[model samples]
Target: MTEKEKMLSGEYYDPGDAELVALRLKARLLTETLNQTSVSDADKRVNIVKSLFGSTGRSIHIESSFNCDYGVNIHVGENFYANFGCVILDVAEVRIGDNCLIAPQVGIYTATHPLDPIKRNSGVEYGKPVTIGHNCWIGGHATINPGVTLGNNVVVASGAVVTKSFGDNVVIGGNPARVIKEIACSDC
Candidate 1:
């Protein structure tokens, strides 16, 4: 199977090898294009992002300091907003649903090296998809690890590290984020 195919299947793939070089080159070019100050038109900017990513919906705003490993593996829904310094290491698929608000310094990473040093040195890395449901709010400096799914309307506090799935209407915080409270409409 192709290297990309391997990655998609959640298998270990060497991104450093020649087979994935083209993808890396494309990502670099797209990153440069996105960073260019010459592109004044919003449509043009959006087009550049769309070309890099697998899919993106309308009315989405990604900040200037955004970075991703493989843009084509990332998909985003409509009305999404990513603030400054957001990084998505999408070696595999990273899907974000509609109306999501991502604060500054938030990281959604899908790539992970093996635990064993020997295996890590071999350049074989595994990846898993990350899914963020609609209308969720991810706070600043939060790290969402691989294979995690955040349910709709979930709120994550700043500096939290999400190591597990979060259910809807919940407020989560801390290093390995855990539910602080279940949000009720009456409280609002």
Candidate 2:
């Protein structure tokens, strides 16, 4: 398989591959333009985000200073909103479901390196996908790590570093986040 294909499949692949480099460059350019756009130009920002992301819902909004690697690997459902300084390293698929809100400085990462120093130093890296379910709220400065799958109506507390998956209707917090409490999902 090609490097891009391997990367998407969560296999170790050379990130310096030409195709991957070009894709990253493209994403960089697009995000730069997106960040520089005047807040008054909402239409233009929306258009740029449409062009940059692989797929997006009808009502998606992202604040300034947003960055991502391989924008095509990121997908968002309806009424998605990301606050300022949101960075997503989408080496693999990063999927966020409907009515998701991401606060400022929130980071969703899908990139990982081998534990073996030799292998890690070889410039071969892999990634695991991240899936956030519907109506999730990621608090400011929270980090969702690789391979984490959060179920619906989950609320992440500020500055939490989530390393593992959690099911629906829970509040998670702290480094290597743990479930703080189960939420009251009234609509569920």
Candidate 3:
């Protein structure tokens, strides 16, 4: 399989492969253009964002200083808004569902290295996909680790480190995020 295929399949792959390097460079350039666009130039920003992500639905708004590895591996659904300094290390797929809000400085990482020092030093890495269900809110400075999936209408408190998946309609918080409470939404 190709390096990209391996990467997408969550297998160990060389990140420094020529094709991967080129893709990252292209994404960096696109993100730079996106970050530089004036807030008043909404149309231009929207166009750039459309080109950056693998797929995006309508009414998507991302604040300045957004960065990602391999923008093509990221997908955002309709009415998605990411606040300033949102960074996604999407070595694999990072999918955000409709009507989601990502607060400032939120880090969603799908990339992970081997635990073994010898293997880690060889520069081979793997990634696990991350998914955020619809209408979820990820608070500022929250870190969503590899392979974690947030269920619909979940609220992750500020500065939380989410290490595992959680079901719908819950409020999670703290260093290693735990269910703080259950949200009783009338619509749910």
CA lDDT scores, all candidates in order: 0.88, 0.96, 0.97
Task: Give the distance in Å from residue 37's predicted Cα in candidate 3 to where it truly belongs.
Answer: 0.9
lDDT of 1 at 157: 99
lDDT of 1 at 179: 95
Q: In model 2, which residue pairs have backbone atoms overlapping below 3 Å? A: none
Off by over 4 Å in 2: none
**lDDT of model 2 at position 142:** 99
Candidate 2, residues 105-162, lDDT tens digits: the string is: 9999999999999999999999999999999999999999999999999999999999
TM-scores, all candidates, are: 0.94, 0.99, 0.99
Order the candidates by TM-score, highest first: 3, 2, 1
Question: Of 1 and 2, which scores higher on lDDT?
Answer: 2
TM-score of 1: 0.94
Candidate 1 wrongly placed segments (more than 4 Å): 38-40, 186-188
Q: Pick the candidate with the highest lDDT.
A: 3
Across 54-84, the per-residue lDDT of candidate 3 in tens digits comes to 9999899999999999899999999999999
